[model samples]
Target: MGVLLTSCSAPSPTPAPRPKVAVTTQIKQLLPATVSNKTAWSEDIYQAFTHQKLETSVSNLCSVIAIAGQESNFNADAPVAGLPHIAWQEIDRRAAALHIPAFVVRTALSVTSPTGKSYAERLDHVRSERELSDIYDDLINTVPLGQQLLGRFNPIHTGGPMQVSIAFAEQHAENYPYKKGNSIRKEVLSQRGGVYFGALHLLGYPANYTVPLYRFADYNAGWYASRNAAFQAAVAYLSGVPLVLDGDLINYQDDKPSQTELAIRSIGFTLQLSQQNIHQQLMLGQSIAFEQSPLWKQVFAAADKKRGQRWPHERLPGITLQSPKISRNLTTAWFAQRVNQRYQNCLLQSRRE
Candidate 1:
C-alpha cells in the first residue's frame, strides 16, 4: 500500500529541434566571387528560393547562378541587340500571317500609347526585350486589331535574368506568392519572379541523371530530354531506323506517332509489345515514369544484347537551338556543356570561399 503511487508509463522523449537554416547567408556564401552587384543578386536569389520552397544547397544555388550568368549575365533587364528591328519584323510577320493590311498595322501602332509616345515610336525605339514585351502587352490588351493579329501571344518567348519560358511560368503560377496584378509574361521579366520560375523550371522535376549536365540540357531542351534521347538511341540501335534524338515522344498536335515512337513500334513484334503499348509508354516521355515502361526496358535489353554490353542510359540530346534570338548555331549539348562549365567554376568558387 505504501508503494501504490508508481507511474504507469515513462514520459515521452523530447524531439530535437531542427537547426535554423540561414538561407540568405547561405546564398551569399555560395554566389560566385566575380559577380557584379553580388548583394542585389544574392538577395533576389534568396527570396526566390525561399518563396518557392526550393532547396538552397550549394549545387542548387550554383545551378541557378550558372543559368542566370549564361542567359543574362545577372542583368534583370538585359538589352537585346537590334530589339527594335526584331519587334518590327515580328509585327510585320504577324500582320502578314493575319492578312491584315500593312497600312492598318502601321496606323494602329501610330496611335498615342500610355507613355505619351506613339506605339510605333515605342516599337522603333525598343532598346530591350522588356520594352518590346510591354508594347506587345499594350497592343494585345488595348488595340482590337492587335488582338486579332497577335492572337493573345506575345513574341517575347523568354525573359528575366534567367530567360525562363513565359508559357512555363504561366502554367505553374498557382502558388505564386506575389500579388497577381501583372500577367506571367510581366513576372518573367522581373528579377525575383523570373528567378523563382526559372529555378522551378530548372530544379522542380525528378530525374535520374548522374551529372548536372543532363539537367542543364533538359533545361535548354525539355524535361527528361536526356532520358528520352537515350531511349531514342536504344530504339534506333534495335530497330535499325535512324531517328533524331530530340526527345519528342509524340507529335503533340496530331495523333500520328512521332518518328521516335514509330521507330519503337517497328520493333514492337521483337519486344512482344503492341503498337498501342509502345505508344502508351512513349507518351510518358515527359516524365520519369517513362523509364519504368516495358518499351524502355525492352529497347535497352535489345540494344545491350546487340552491343554485348550495357549502353549508357543518358546522353546529350541532339537538338539545335533554333530561336530567333540565337544567331549562331547551337545545340542542346553545347548549351549544357557551357552551363556545366559555369556550374563547375561556381562549385570551385564556393569551395574556395
Candidate 2:
C-alpha cells in the first residue's frame, strides 16, 4: 500500500458560542436623567422588532438598542422647541406657493376635532411630533377643507430629546410588542420595556440594503428608498443625466412633467416602454409591485455589474443631523457610523461568547 497517501484532513474547529452581553443595563445607564419613561422605551424597542416580525439575534437587538439609546434616550414625549416657529414659516411658504390664502389656511385650522377643540388651539400649542401628527390626522378626518389645504400634511419632525419617526409608528402599529398597553400613545412613554420595543422599531427592520446609511435614510425618509435609489442611479448613469442620490422617486413640483419622469422618457424608447406605460409603472413604487417589474431586474443587473461592488439600494443622506441642543454636524452619517460601530462591537462580543 502506497503509504496511505489519503492524508487525514485536520478537523475544523467548531465556532464558539456568542457571549452573553448585558446590553440593557449599559443602555439604561446612558439614558438621560430627564427620561422617566423606561417602560415606554422598552416597549417601543420590543415593538420595533416584533412589529416587523423581525427575528433578531440578541446581539443584533443589542446593536439596535445601542442606537436607540443614543438617539432618543428613552423620551417618547420629546419635542424640538423651535419647531412651532419653523412650522409657521413652512405653512406660510406653502400657502404662498399654492395661492391658498393665508387666512384660508388659518381658517382650516379653526375646524374642530371630535372633542370639538379648534385645531388652531392644537396647532398653536403643538410641541411633540406625535401631538402635531394627531392634530393633522384629526384635520383630515374632521375638517371638510382639510384635505385640499393641508393634504400633504406630514410635518417633518427631526429633533428634540428623542428623534422618533412619526411616520414609522403610524404605519406599523400592529407589530408593537406591548400587548398589555391600552394604546400606542400611552405605551410610548411607559417605561424601559416599552421604550426598548419602540427603539427596535426605529432600527431593526431589514432591507436588501448593503449598508446602514439607507436604513438611516429610510428611518428619516421611508422604507423603499434603497431600491428606488438603485433605479434612479441606473437611469441617471444610462441616460447620461445627473440626478441626486437622495432617492426622491417622484417630482413634487407643480409642473405637469416631473424631472424623474423626463429621465424615464429619455430611456423609454431604449427599454421599449411607452411614456404612458412608464408613468403607470411609477405608481407600482408605492407598493412592492415595482420589484416584480422586468425593468427593475434589467436595470439592477446592469447597474450591479457596472459598479463592481454592490450598489446601495437606498437614499443618499438627506440633511445633516443638526440641532440647537447639540453641537456639531451630527449628521445621519455620523449616527449610522456610531450604530454600526456598536453593531461591530456587539458582534465581537458575541463571538467571544
What would the TM-scores of all predictions be?
A: 0.91, 0.58
* Residue 179 local lDDT, model 2: 67
Poorest stretch of ten by lDDT in candidate 1: 1-10
Model 2's number of clashes is 43
Model number with the top TM-score: 1
Local distance difference test, candidate 1:
0.81
lDDT of 1 by residue, 261-343 (tens): 78877878899999888888777889878878888888888889899999878899999998767799999999999999999
Show model 1 residue runs off by greater than 4 Å. 1-21
After superposition on all C-alphas, the RMSD of every candidate to the true structure, in Å, is 9.0, 9.8
Tell me how far the alpha carbon of residue 263 in candidate 1 is from the true structure, in angstroms, after superposition.
Answer: 0.8
Residues 158-208, candidate 2, lDDT per residue (tens digit)? 332235443444555665545645444434433433344344444444345
| Clash pairs (backbone) in predicted model 1 | none
